[model samples]
Every structure is written in C-alpha cells, then in structure tokens.
Target: MTFFYNLWYSNSLQYKLISLMLYPFSLLWIIIDKLKFLMTKPYTSHLKIICVGNINVGGTGKTPISIFIFKILKKMGHNPIFLTSGYKGKISKPCIANNDVILFGDEAIILKNIGPTVVSKNKLEGVKYIENLNSKRKIYDIIVMDDGLQNYSIGKDLCFLTVDRKSLFGNEFCLPSGPLRQSLNSCKKNINKIILTGNRNFKKNHNILKKDILNSYIKVDKVSVKKKYLAFSGLGNNVKFFDTLKSANYNIALTKEFEDHHNYKENEIADLIKLANENNLKLITTEKDIVKIPKKYHLKINCLKMKIEFDKQDLISLKSLLKNKLND
Candidate 1:
C-alpha cells in the first residue's frame, strides 16, 4: 500500500510507466466497486445516521469532524453513538468503550474516548447492536459512521465528503494508479456537501458539481515547547501533521512518517526515545497516533490535540440540514 501510494504521487518516468501498467487494475477495481454498490441493498435504520467520509484513501479530517458532530449532537440533547468497522482491529462482535475493553484499532480507540462507540465488521450489524442496546437502555438517539462513504451496505441520512483541497484526487486516477478510493464522479452523487480541510478557498467556479464547501481546518492546541523537537506520526498524511506544526512555527528538528494506523512496538518506542535524547529533542506526534502508544511511555512523548470547526453560518446550515433530515 505504501509503495503504491508513493508511486501514485511520483513524477519520475519509471513511476509513470508503473502507474500506466496498473491502470487496468484500477479500472477493474472501479468496476467491482460499482458492482458492489449496484448489488447491495443498503440496510436502513430507524435512527438518524450521519456519515463523514472522504474519496481519498487517507485521512482528510474525518475523525475530528465526526467528533465535532458527536459533540454537537450531545449538545442538542440527543445521544449519538459511533459505529465503525474497527479497521485492522479484531472486533468480531459489537463492543462499547470501557477502560477494561481493549480497542484494537487506532481510530476506534480515539472515538471511544469521545463517546459511546461500537465496532463490528458489518455496518448493519453494528447499527443493530446499538439499536438493541437502546431498546434495553434507551442510550442513543443517533448513529454516526466515521468513514464509510464507499460502503453502501448502510443507508445514511446525511453524508459529508471531506477533501484536502491541495491533494484532492491526486493525479485524477483511482487506486494503484492514484490516491482516489473511488472515481470523483461516482462519489459526487453521494456527497451532500464538501468539507475543504485546507487554507485554499474553494470557489464555486472550481471544476466540479455545484456543492456547499465547509471551510474548515483541524484546529490544534497551541504547544508551549520552545525547544527543537522531533515530529513523527503514522497517519495517511504524516506530512500534513508536520506541515501543521511548521505552519505554527514549531522548531521541528526532524520528522518521520509511518503507514497510516501504524501499531507501535516497545522497541520502536524505545528507538524514538533514544533518538530524541541523542538529538536533545522532544518527541511529539498527533493525538490519533499517540493513543496507540502504551500508557507507560506516554509521559515520554507529547501529542497535538485537534478538532474541526466550521464557520458559524456553515455550521448552522449543517445543523439545519441534520434537523430536517431527522424530522423526516
């Protein structure tokens, strides 16, 4: 996956030839993806389901935005629970967040900390699990799917397609050919609005369907550390996290990138600590990445906590849409 991701972005002649060779496979991927959508009848739930997903394979502010929605729903006096496939996690049955519960997925751990969370391989089964709990306890009023825009097995009442304006649809190709999980046109019909998670102002004149652009960015807390520090993360866009630090004038001594949702080992943690001490640098990483680290080593590292915020009017518009949909 990392090799293909790098090749998809490379401009060298060899990479282009490789991409061309993989183009046929990408077409096959698109056909199979489309057929899956055509063949599957989405499972509908009685509760309102809002999905925050992206066309790009990697992170584009989905976690933060989903958390934002979860908080908003809480404020609105409605209970909301997160339902996810528990990517890369061994969650065969529905499980909720608890200190004693072991969360196998990086994103799942983070989401669990925010509110009630359920992890299951099947989205429909996850929803049903939560609904069953509600029947016994009346614990939740809504369900939020963190990243299932491409998964058509679960019907959604609202959908927000997130995009990083700078890297939207890299090379305009799919899968091994490029970064897109699905073709741009195929995703447009499912997206109710586009959330641009960058500084570039999205203009209506931009070449795409006319849709509302939610101007926002991942709002990180200000760090007080003044010394040079080593920044590292296992994120889809590790560079983006580093770039965010650079934008904030952080004294980045060095940076390292790892595959998204990377599981950390004791040896790797020790290595990072050793490297940081050798360079007299503090080790820092993203909140999402930090959660996966063992607690005993947490004091050895720092994390940049972030949240997503939309403009006032834009947020109001979003809430209005949600309210209208739920009322239906």
Candidate 2:
C-alpha cells in the first residue's frame, strides 16, 4: 500500500481511472448506504453505545478513542462492552473480547483492559450476545464500538468519526484509488461528533476537517530526559510517532520503521534487542504492536498512552449528550 500510495499520488491518470471505476460504485454505495440508513433504522440500545469510526480506511486513532470512551463510560459507573469487526482474527462464533493479542488483535486486547469487549463480523450477533446475556450479570451497561461507522446493523447512541491529520483525504478519492472507506461528505451528516487525532493542526484546511472539527494537541505532561528507550511503531506514519515521543521529551535512542500491521519475526526481534543493547536503550512499542509480540517478551514491552482533550464546549456538550444517551 505504501509503495502504491506514492505511485497513485504521483500519477493523476492512474488515480483518475481508479476513481472513475470506483465512482460508479461510490455513487451506488451512497444510495445503498442511504437506503440502508433509512430502512434499517437505528435501534435504541438498552445500554448506550458510542461508536468511534471514520471516513478513512485506517489510522485515524479510532482504537484510542474507543478505549477512552470505554474508560469514560466505566468511570460513570456503567459497565461497557466493546465491539469490533475482528479484522484479522479467527473466532467465527461471537465471543467476549479477551486480552489475548494473538487471538483478538492488539486493539481489542487493549480495549478489554477497560471493560468487556466482543469481536464479531456480524454486528447484530455481537449486539444479540448482550441482549441475551444474564439479566442479572448484565456484564455491560453500555457498549463502545470500534470502527463501526458504516455498519448499520448495530445502532449507536453516539458516533465520533476520527480523521488522520496528515492524510485527511487521500488523493481526495474513494477506495481502490485513495484511502477513504466512504466519502467525506457521508461522515459530516451521520456522525454525532468528529475527532481530529494527532498534532492540533493535522488537517487544517480540508474544507471537511478544518472548518470546525479540529481539537488541540494533547500535550505531554512528562517524559524521561537523560536515559530513553527505542520506541518503534508501525501505525500510520512513523515520523509522526517519533515526533510525538520527542515532543513528550523522550530522547529516543533508536527508531525502527515497518509497514502497518507487520508481523514481527524472531530474527527481527533479536535484531531489535541487539540494537537496543548496543545503543543502551529499552524497547518501547505501541499497544497495537505489543500485542503481536509473543507473551514471553511481554515483560520487556512498554507502550505509550495518550489523552484526548476535547474543546471545552464540545466536551461539555458531549458529556451531557452521553449522560442522556446512557440513561435513555
């Protein structure tokens, strides 16, 4: 994708054809999406559901936002359930989210730390799991769904669509030509809230994000000064991740970059260990990456966590909306 992304951006002709082909489907998708929206009709959850989704295909920090929502819901004294499509995991039968990265992927694994989670491609199945649960042990008071924006099956009490600052709208085209899973226009009308992740000014002037959805950068409170560790992440952009560590005041000893969702091999792990030792650094990775790492190395793993600072007005409005959503 990285290699092709460059080629697609550079060649307008290539980009145009791809877009043209998708254009018909994109149009059809809009109609289908609208019909689905109108026909399916959003169902009210007995327990509240907040979904963190986005227009982009990936890398909008949806997972982080999902985790934050889970925490917020629990802090309010409501049990929360996380729902995901289980992108690459195996478990055909719907199941509760577990803390096994290998089994449920890193995102869902981190989510479980906050509350109960369920991974199922069948959205209704996940919802039904909760509806049919013991009325006594009603494990979840609410649900936080990760990446369920276009999914019409399970209705959300609230929806926050995430946007990557750097690649806000890849080539301004839809899938196969660009990174968007749906049109940017689709997000604005459907989403209850829009969250812009990364540096404060990530996608400053895209007409879509810049106008009103931007949120300030969540500043780093403290960081290790003298001795630092080598932090490597394979999320969206490696440079930005490195910059974030630096901004947080960590003097990174060494940084290694890799493709998104890369599977770390034994030899590669050994190389990282050697590099860290040679440079006198510890290994720090993102929660997403750490999950792929075998448990034998779990003790050696460290991940950085971030805070989301919503605007004062937005925050107040959101809190109120959520309270009502959860109550109703």
Candidate 2's error at 272, in angstroms?
1.4
* Clash count, one per candidate: 0, 1
lDDT of model 1 at residue 153?
A: 88
Measured by TM-score, how close is model 1 to the native structure?
A: 0.92
Instruction: Summarize candidate 1's per-residue lDDT along 142-254 as a digit string, tens digits.
Output: 99999999989889999998877656666778887888888887888888988778532333224364678777765666665577889999988877788778766678989
Clashing pairs in 1: none
Per-residue lDDT of 153 in model 2: 71
TM, every model: 0.92, 0.82
Per-residue accuracy of model 2 over 192-270 as CA lDDT, tens digit each: 7667677654446355543346353555546659877888887755666777777778788788988776778878887
The candidate that achieves the highest TM-score relative to the unseen native structure: 1
In candidate 2, stretches whose alpha carbon ends up further than 4 angstroms from where it belongs are 4-45, 134-139, 201-216, 219-221, 224-229, 236-239, 252-254, 279-281, 298-301
In terms of lDDT, the poorest run of 10 residues in model 2 is 209-218
